[model samples]
Target: MPDLSPAAFILLQGARVFAPDDLGICDVLLAGGKIIAIDSAIPADIVPDCQLVDLSGRWLCPGFIDQHVHLIGGGGEAGPTTRAPEVVLSRLTRAGITTVVGLLGTDSVTRHPESLLAKTRALNEEGITAWMLTGAYHVPSPTITGSVEKDVALIDRILGVKCAVADHRSAAPEKGQLASMAAQSRVGGLLGGKPGVTVCHMGSSKKGMQPLYDILETSDVPIGKLLPTHVNRSEYLFEQAIEFTRKGGVIDITSGIPEPIPPAQAIDRAVRAGVPLAQLTLSSDGNGSQPKFDEAGNLVGIGVAGFESLLETVVELVNGYRFTLPDALRPLTSSVAEFLGFDNKGAIAPGKDADLLVMTPDLVIDRVYARGRLMVKDGVACVKGTFE
Candidate 1:
């Protein structure tokens, strides 16, 4: 469980704060799990009992928000033994991910919605923010409340639903079915006061975004309601995603895609092609299986995704591609937090949750604070999950 001790004030000095906007050298004050003050210098005499840490020469940025993850484990395409293990707490904090959105993937049969919900709550208790989408690859997808609309409207943890499209594993529902699901998700989001987006898993099928286009052409569902992921899986799909973003829809690029356009390169391409940065986001399909299939449609090899890839991609965007720190920070931080409706996350301004990362000049995470508690200090985890 989260450390529930009486609130302690913390004063950090001499850090270059990003707020993701390069706030220059500043002193930040944290108390009661929130950022209470950020200034050029906070008077130490005001809070005499506060603990002070000298963060000179370190870079401080908001903690990352990974919008797509398999918290309860995903996969089972090969066999029961191939199901990936659940993600532990240290794995996320070490990678600087303070908030995560979990989902069921290809193996919705073996993993139920309740299990996903329980695991989300478990992560929250372990001291991080967590939320989830209700369904998985199958349409008429599995849910805790039996109906998609009811699931989002009633379940506080559920922000939306997910389904597979244009993939061999997907049920390949008709266009009308897709429209109905989108409608239900939209209504559920309206009732629940959340972004009831239908997160679509885009596969490498030749259909290539036609299903989404058909839905927009036939129904009244707005373009913003559908979020397609894995757009970097193939060049053709990536182009289609860029066009979708230009048309005011959001697109999510997965960090683990192999070959062709990698996540960093894809982001660069999107920026150059005039895609609005706000409409683009990146996610780590962490703890889910990354399978390779033979021409005959058999799963020949399987590998699991790691959460660290998310941070690695961001680092590459800055160090390798010459992106400004704030530009590289957008997709993983502020953009995602805004997309998911997390009011208190995504930035380091006052009144935001005290989820901040202290990184070395080279971008290695040196310390991590989530909700005013130090989770990692000097590259080592200070707090670990119950079973970790």
Candidate 2:
């Protein structure tokens, strides 16, 4: 029911725009899968036969860019039956996530990087934008190609590589290996026209972020190229995250974690401690298994992360705290776009992708757009996966 031609023009009028910068009330024009114009007023006739949608009371915002997700599902801690299900199209769109960077987690042996690539393509065809990282939690990380460099440079949809550390589940790749992989990813990004950043999965272990610091101290890898996620897992780890941020490394706070204080408060503590907000980002880690362990390292409980937390955390940052709308949106929007080196995303500006969201006064997602396509409307997904 949300069908529209790829090039069709749509005019949204009288919307309170966030552009993630609080543009006040404005009209936005969309065409050719890009935002053509944004101004105080644009007559309906400005573009001949453009479909006009009235949104006088809605808040228009840039759709979220969830940096960490398992598009083909991520799990396996509980056993073979615990692997999560593949992400369907509506699950992402309805959650207001317009773009995603997919990856594999702990079980790369059974789940291949090639399947993740296929899912990325599938998401694009399903009316949203998607990219992926190669490898899992293991060292000598698995790759579609024989090497990380080849995966990043040759694979069009692959942005870089992924690995884990500081937990019992990780391969515990040495700092030398970390530095080498980061360097390879950076060079691959240069060659492939993508941000070949290494996405490091941080676990809640006593080691915290020491491996990253060691890599920085002993190697030539730039601080910006390493993106450590799940920094909000514990209080002490969050402290290390602050230190890493002060040292100019980008830290990703996982929003789906429900323990050790809320992610919004963790971000607030970072801001109070003089950590630059631009260096911080928030991702859902959606579809990944969040397994809890006792002091004995036994799995006590588990839950699958979902895409909803990105929107929920953003709202909390504003209404529940001192953050302005733009500041609250930075992590999931501009900051993420900047970190991923995506030129056409993260803001509601002209020349950007038409990935916009419409929200009600109380912060419910009302309508959504991805690549200029109406993927969701009235808080429900209008499009679905092929098998759905």
Candidate 3:
């Protein structure tokens, strides 16, 4: 509503701030796409041209950061026709996701790293922060420059490499291959100054987490470097993840799980099981295909995932499970941001990017700001994609 463009100066007043850790009621000033000041009050005369908005009844928190998404769309397992469509900007902004980490899933052949990089740039152009991972489900995984190290080192937007392990669709790489990939990513991260994490897509296979365990037992790759996602797909997988987190590794829970343990419940279980809260993160897997396969590996049904589920899970954690607001917000915000090395994102503070969300008491999104630009106001999107 506030012109749908980046504001030179904007003041959000009287809001209960979360900085993702409850900063009490405060006035936040945004300028040059960063939070310049946060205090109990900011004199209007100090910045005569600043736009002032009273958010007395709203709750302000750091914008959500979704770590795993298919920006250019995922899935080709069923066929070319079943490839998920590209995600639009409004969907992300409306869902309170100000930053996203894009990746390719089962089909890196049809969807190239070039396209992923281009889409990430496109999102940034539209005023959202976006980064990506290289490779897909195969070992000898595809890369922009023919190697994982080169891709992470040279590509400014590429943060790490993504591959499937212990899944039916995975390359089923031997332990040596897994260690080599992990080493390459670690060195690349060190040289490039990026997180350089290996984002592994875990599956429903009975092998569970054995491959990752083998990698840890036999190699020097730090457990932190191995980020296994979709750990909540089943109770058994979730149990394995609980152990992994207890050992100082991080596990990513997908929001759109089908049955036994939904992501919110998974978090509850993980907390009860004594897994470190800081070691858990959540992702939407948005725009990726959720394909159900028969015993013979035939695709029987396919459903597209939605990014909105991330916020929905957060709300459930707070309102239904009685988790504190800050605890409910961590996995969606700071935890993911810290793990992904997004230094400027994941929190609302004086030096952080002006990515903030305003929510009503009932947990509905009332407004969203990304890097000092208002994208949604009063739960309505004011900005859209080039084609939307």
Candidate 4:
């Protein structure tokens, strides 16, 4: 339930508004979790009791939605000692990630889907909208009640199935297995009216997207069903991701550190290379471990991906890379929201959820709102779950 104050909260005077529909010079009225009105001005006396916030001609955009994140623990390659801690609510709130799709990575046995679901619910109950992927790195992916198809179709928050492909730690399911997963996901998505995608966690393997291409060529599954993430991890993988976008499949470029290329450069190159704008999405891979492996698959070092990197990715795009806020913000906001079936998210509209971020001229996250509730304000989180 959302806090529906009898008074309509009014946000006045923003420098620019990218409300997805390009609504200009409007004041937004938020009541409960929904925007009840958008106009030049609201009657101040009508909602005299409402809280007032002045933007002072700063940028206001939809809060970012991270589609692929390891919200729970991620690594286990270095043994039990290497398992990452669970993500706290404030970490996401401060970073302006109002919505997240948590997933299990590499070690599915140690961290199951049920635990992921519980964590997601904990976040939701704490006020931030959260969801999860159905499966993990292995082919026989773990599930709440078993079966990726059934889990995605029948489970409430289970939106899609993710598996490792072209990675040493993965089952590296054959093209046939990939096709079957996509087919089941497609049907499940249709049944649930959700985007049923086979979110493939691409590895550092030089095989590139050959298996993906094979699956697409042999199966009746639509190209939209195949989503290859971390496509910017390597030069060849980045090129393959762009090519995949050209062929109608969606590609996710991670904001996490790239092995050889910087993430900003990869994004710029992808855009410059003319990849379909809508086909491209971005994620933080937050709370997950970035492990580097040697030739013999020995773990040499590890780095953690931060939620703040998501906003930093946008800042680099707009300031240094010459991309407009609308262009760079889309993949982080509207594009990912639309893909994941979060209808009320990723846009500013009359009836849309009041999920937003207030940024300074330098593109720093000043405040955040999830479904009309103020979570982060003035560079600090105002609301957080008890677990942390």
TM-score of 2: 0.97
> Which regions of candidate 1 are displaced past 4 Å?
1-7
Question: What lDDT score belongs to each candidate, Candidate 1 first?
Answer: 0.90, 0.89, 0.89, 0.81
TM-score of each: 0.98, 0.97, 0.97, 0.95
Q: What are the clashing pairs of model 2? A: none
Off by over 4 Å in 2: 1-4
**Model 3 residue 214 lDDT?**
80
Two-way TM-score contest, 1 vs 3, winner: 1
Q: Global lDDT for candidate 3?
A: 0.89
Per residue, candidate 1 scores C-alpha lDDT tens digits across 329-363 of: 88988888878888899999899999999998899
Maximum-lDDT candidate: 1
- Candidates 1 and 3 compared by lDDT, better number: 1
Q: For residues 1-388, write the lDDT of model 3, one tens digit per residue.
A: 1244577889999999988888889999999889999998888766878899899989999999999999999888889999999999999999999999999999977899999999999898888899999988988888889899989988999899898987998988888888788778878888899888899999988888888888787778899989999999877888888988888999999997746688899998898888766888999999999998888888899989998898889988998889888999999888988888788988888889999999987889999999989989999988888778
